[model samples]
Target: MTTVTKNKVTDLFLENAPSFGSFLSLREESKQIVNEKGLPAAKDEEYKFTSVSKKLEQVITDFSTAKPIAVSKDTIKDHLWAGFEGSYLVFNNGIFSKELSAFENSGFGVQMLSESNAIALGSIAKAEKDPFIALNTIYFEDGIQISIPRGKKVDSPILFLFFNQANEGQIISPRILIEVAENAEATFLEHSISLDEAVYFSNSVTEIKVGQNSHVHYSRLQNDGSKAIVVSNFETDIHRDATFTSTVVSLSGDLVRNNLSLRLQDSGCVGNMYGLYLLNGKTHVDNHTNVDHTKPHAESNELYKGILTDQSRGVFNGKIFVRQDAQKTNAFQQNNNILLSEDAIVNTKPQLEIWADDVKCSHGCTTGQLDEEALFYLQARGIDKMQAKGLLLYAFAGEVLEHINDESFRNYIDGLVQERLGSNF
Candidate 1:
């Protein structure tokens, strides 16, 4: 009988040897931590919501270094970045492609980082254990670093473009780190688009640290192919009196998982998180968010909604933790979903763990089908059954979409939802 050995994450690290040699001195330490502790199993309290064991098992077979992949601007303009203005940073196969990017260095302090300069920042270490992040740090050839001078307000939105070409059976990992100076304000838009029909995997991580009293707005649009699989993690650190808001929209993917963590480290900080996911076919989408309030008077609000049709599945796990010293903290979370087909499945969990008794915290979740009365009322108003259903679904999602502060972006998302619903409107 022949035996097949499953590839372990350790194997990927070993084969890539030199790429990860940067951590060689600590390889033994990391290996011990990973192999012995490894990634938490499905039972791990932190990862209990999403099962990554089977997914992690799909490690690289040979583990060779990645070569630069060429991309063209004309191709990007024709396929992605169709409608948008401002700066664009394009990356392919986890390597930044400068030719495909455009920038206006008009005094906002936005510039690409020289390799040496990025290394000096010393912030990348926070993402070391993230497998994809490790891969990017080791293999990533180049990436853009946007630095807003202290107190500079970036009026134009900065867009990060990750394009996955038609590379069948290949995996890509992209890494990004943003630093916002005190009292700085900026908006970031990241989108992944591809024209290929192959089943590619995009594993990426983004870390943002908001300086004291700074404001950062981040939005991610995941519009990969239905056959594509993606895993993304975003972590942000908010300082005193800073505002950090993020919204994620997942349109398509075979299996998509997004993990977002926000650490409110100082008092008077505000954290806001919102997500919308639509799943169909056999696609599975999971959105998990964690908010930690470590100081007094911090506030956090989270709301997520999902729509599952066909035989697809959706999951949402939102958690809030208030430390013992985090008195007067206000935290609220809610997750709602609608299942269109009997075969569709939706799992939603909203949790709050508070150690301070003087805090006001609340969490609630609901999963159910469409309102029959609302549908009947629309139908009675002369709307066709399918059209009526689409309208109701749009209205249900509009409440969440309305929270989006940007009107143009909200309209763009509304158009996407309308097209997905197949409503003539």
Candidate 2:
């Protein structure tokens, strides 16, 4: 891993890096914030369990000199989700692939961030405390933006496919924005994949705003290559009587970290966040989530589960905040993990801060191995130990998978989980 410091970041990256088109002109305020807050060191409380500072130097040294991956149209068509039933928008190497994309959102509007679009937007994200968001603001110029009209409901879900390929140590930035108008409803399925195995980095950001009385379902499934390093931030804003649901699944990566934040600013708003990870080999995954209840009568629920095999490691941090004005707030959080190997490691922390006397809030975490008694019972039933362990692990992770309302999508994810268990366990 490369060593990260204030001097190295300035001398090696900012000083000699090429410009990022029109985005550079709109990054004054964010640059100031990045300079002031800086990147979180290993000693920082927020990033203690995950060695983010140690891994930072590897991602930025050659990031400014990366060239676009050489890919043909046939390569993109061969690697897509076949049964989505909805039109797809493809981003090839972090740039919108207009020629290879289908153009139907089932009454929703789609806008790619052009120069004019970039000029119209004010601020891209609310992650002021994070330095990766600042890096994205400085280098990203294109992404997807979707808007649903008031009271309009789309039956078919929209697909957002991000294909990142860098064979010679490159970096890519992918961004997305979605807004569901008042009383409208929409669903988005996002897939992140790495096309090449060589060392590379992908920094992605997604912002979602749900209007009053609207609902939005956002799912992110990541299965990158072995040499891929990923950092993504997912932020959500919920209004009165609205609902926001997020499902994050991590199946494969060399190193992956996710920072998710949500704010409930009005009464009757509902926020649900769920995460599931299956790690093997030397893969590492870290998930940090924050939910803020700023208004009365708001509710938030969170659950994250992980299965680590071989020498893999996993970390989870969940925080819930109920303000003084958030009377009658209901917040619950839980984190659980199963370690299959003696060398596998897991760190889980669930925290809650509530100021309102009338609110109900709770948090709990557990990290342990599977039950030997159950394995013995399955062995007596003529089942092999490996198959029996896979079965038990699948059943352990099914609780969060049950929340996926889309049956076909749920079944697809079930297949991935089964394959991982059979091979890793």
Candidate 3:
């Protein structure tokens, strides 16, 4: 038996090696917020469904710097985004790759931020106690800092490329910061992909702050290799009258978990979250989201759908919190899952903690197979059994995909869904 050490990096940092003095301040700050002794286990309320302790038992080599590699444009040709003609930031193996990236401007300036720029953005994410975040803060070599000037409406969408190519036992961390100034409107897409067959681990963090009356659309697509392991956290703060919408799709990974938290700090703000996951062949995927309505008249809506097949496992835990002073808050949450095989399993929980008297909050979750009646009805209309099943499965997921405002992006995802469903669809 092997003993698992928790927060090994933090422990090493605190022990006075101080070789990386540049990150000393950050390490100290993180130690103040996070529990440094015990690793988060399955018993922790927030990590009930996801546990990396077993995998962490293995010794992991700390990756602090990356060796620059030359990558041809043709290598990334198959990954070019569709209908996106705005700013682009590309990262390979957690290191920013300049040659493989493309950027377009329609008048307003869009550029990657230097180290000086990262200093200011780092100040905004100082309130959290996350180990993954701590590691990323100190070691992330380069991060894309996107600043949309006030009142500017970007006609096109910005694309962020997080491409990884590593073999067994390798670890990668990519960091990003996005700031939308007051009344500015923009969209961002974060895509993660891997081409190699490796049991690698990827730890990523993205911090976003939406200014007053700003509108931001953020999408995260995790389509890594089946042998990959990923853990990511996204933290966002919304201001008065601002709108923030996010959709997460998880399609591949040996063990994957996403932690999403939104702070509705100001009144008259709206937050929407949507997620979809398709798992098969012993994969394990979990999504845990928290929406906090801390001010009056704030609103939040969330819907997540999952399709699990073979012997795969899926988990969804969604929570909505309405503070006492958050009067007139309207929040709703729902989680639905479809299990295609008897060996497949899904664990879903929708939690609502409301402390406001005049708030409207509700949450519900259901896990089951496709409706037999609906499948039979479709098959009666000349559709074969497999086709009918595929049609019903696509329809089940279409509800969430419909929320995407970009027609081109939505179409691409539609095609991906069909591909995942195979000839049946």
lDDT for position 363 in model 1: 94
Quote the positional error of residue 120 for candidate 2 in Å.
Answer: 8.9
- TM-score per prediction, in order, is 0.88, 0.93, 0.91
Q: lDDT of candidate 1?
A: 0.73
lDDT of 3 by residue, 355-387 (tens): 989988888988988899999998889999888
Local accuracy by lDDT, each model: 0.73, 0.79, 0.76
Residues 1-425 of candidate 2 have per-residue lDDT tens digits of 24344534533434444465555555655565556665666777888877654675755456553445655667656755556676667877777776777765479887776633633243436547577777666666577777789999888777777778765556677777777789998888878777767677787887888999998888778899987888898888899999998888899888898999999989999999999999999999999999999999999999999999899999999999999999999998999999989999999888888889998888898998998999999999999999989889999899888877556667778888898888757
Which pairs, if any, clash in model 2?
Answer: none
Clashes of 2: 0
> In model 1, what is the error at residue 86, expressed in angstroms?
0.8
Instruction: Please identify which of the two predictions, 1 or 3, would achieve the higher lDDT against the true structure.
Output: 3
**True-structure RMSD, every candidate:** 3.9, 3.0, 3.3
The true-versus-predicted C-alpha distance at residue 227 of model 1, in Å, is 2.1
Using TM-score as the measure, what is the rank order of every candidate, best first? 2, 3, 1
